[model samples]
Target: MAAEAKQSSYDGSHVENFEFYLQCSGEHESILHFLMKHLPEEFERIGADKSGLAVLGVGSGGGEVDVQMLSLMQSTLSALPITADIVEGSTELVAKFKGLVTKTDHLQKIPFTWHTMLSEEYMQKTKGRGDVKTFDFIHMIQMLYYVDDLTETIKFYHSLLNKNGRLMIIIESANSGWDTLWRTFSKELCNEILPVYRSSSDVLASLKSLGLKYEEHFIPNTFDITECFDPNSKTGQHLISFMTGRENFYQSFTPRVRADILNVLRSKCSTEKEGKVSFNSEMRCVFVYA
Candidate 1:
């Protein structure tokens, strides 16, 4: 029988690990480029004739992406007043986000409300209230993997959008390395108790099933995973842990399981050339309109 190792989502305790993962993943650059090239038109479509906007960031981590998106929105909308609500589960990440906001002078003009809670909790709290606040823009970036119910979560967020509002979701593409890894080893690596290992393909399927209209765009990205093949590398181990959503994966998983995972990662999820492995970290963004 396979050994049953403990599993948990990233939080304050694993903030460093998550940050390291982000640094190695090349995801930030891909997302930023996509936003810079495409978001102005999106903002124009959604913000036309509007003097004010309510924006929500779900699972916003460290606020780097949030700040960039908000800055673009401000520039595109020029004179519009924007209010941002951030929902993040990690205390450490929330503190980092707050600190980033404090240092950003342009963001100082915009009001931000922080909710240090998970998206599910925030959704429940809002739904339970006598008066529910609607939003003009909502972005859930690379965060749906932690949700309990993907379909229900999409439905809830969609319901919160005002007419002409936009709900943007970014996740791993169906053809990305993440999708390949999770599809191959979900039974071995994914936590059975918590939601994890989902990709953009799953999100699109849900949106279609719910009778929602959405547009999808692909962002191609690649990252070096040569370190991941080296068992002695601490950075490699952290990257592996992040990929598997299992802390200390190299130390915790059985030797057989670990070896199998490494084999799959190298041969299936990434390309190796000249002794270097490049992971196909492509991502997809889905835009749904209300």
Candidate 2:
């Protein structure tokens, strides 16, 4: 029922709109709040003393969120030397992130190593190196959707954590608007190049099955997706492609399917009030302790 051999829209062409989508979604603010609230206390409990923190950023896109996270952690652990290992695959994004870091003064306080590879590749590299490093905190923010084996990926990252270290993750909650879009269009529009979409609920179930105890927090988010209703709009088409993980998803769909998808977007996936269409963009943050 799904499309065969379609490339994901997360490439360079779609990155701009995807960043816009993230801007409107308010996911970043929620994540910042979670970090500010939990990290200080968590660091304290983990015995913040002589040795500084070692952090890992998995799927760190454009490094914006990575910078924010490190900034806050720096504030909490004032004058504490920190080492960061950044794992990202996109050359352009990593360049942009590094550029941003160069301009920021506080970010320079935390020295970092850049790994231009996927998380699995980084894991294999580390294995080859023989456990030379252990992370005090590892974050996989809105990135697990790229990995094929979620449970194994989780375990691998968890194994990288030092004792009392934390692995934080963020993902869309099930039955939210994002989930609705994927579930509705998956039969015809699903992209094989992308990993199967898994929501926070699915992740929690997987963790439970593995006998892992974790803390969960819900982040209430919403975005105005009115542009998606107009098939002629470039941003709209880009968003459709992003949601379905297909390139030119609007163009790929039959005229009837396109219309139906729009109708469902307006009626089911979004709420219309004051002539503004807002999508249910709730997300969840899960914390697993080592």
Scored by lDDT, the top model is: 1
Error of 2 at 264 (Å): 2.3
Q: Model 1, range 1-290, lDDT digits (tens) per residue?
A: 01111112445546776667778877788899999999999888888888799999998878989999998998889889999999987777788899988998999999999998888899899989999889999999888877788999999999999878999999888967888888788777666643357788789889999999999999899889898888789888778877776778877789999898889889988999999999888888899989
> How would you encode candidate 2's per-residue C-alpha lDDT over 1-290 as one tens digit per residue?
01112112344765665675566566677767767777777766654553688999988878877887788777777766889999887776778889999999988777879988877788788878854688899998887766778888998898888887889888888888878877777676554555466788778987888888799988777777888777688777666666655668766778898788778878988899988899887788898988
Best by TM-score: 1
lDDT per model, in order? 0.83, 0.76
> Candidate 2's error at 260, in angstroms?
2.5
Return the TM-score for each candidate structure.
Answer: 0.94, 0.90
Worst 10 residues of 1 by lDDT: 1-10
Clashing pairs in 1: none
Candidate 2's TM-score: 0.90
Q: How big is the positional error of residue 237 in model 1, measured in Å on the Cα after superposition? A: 1.9
Determine the backbone clash count of candidate 2.
0
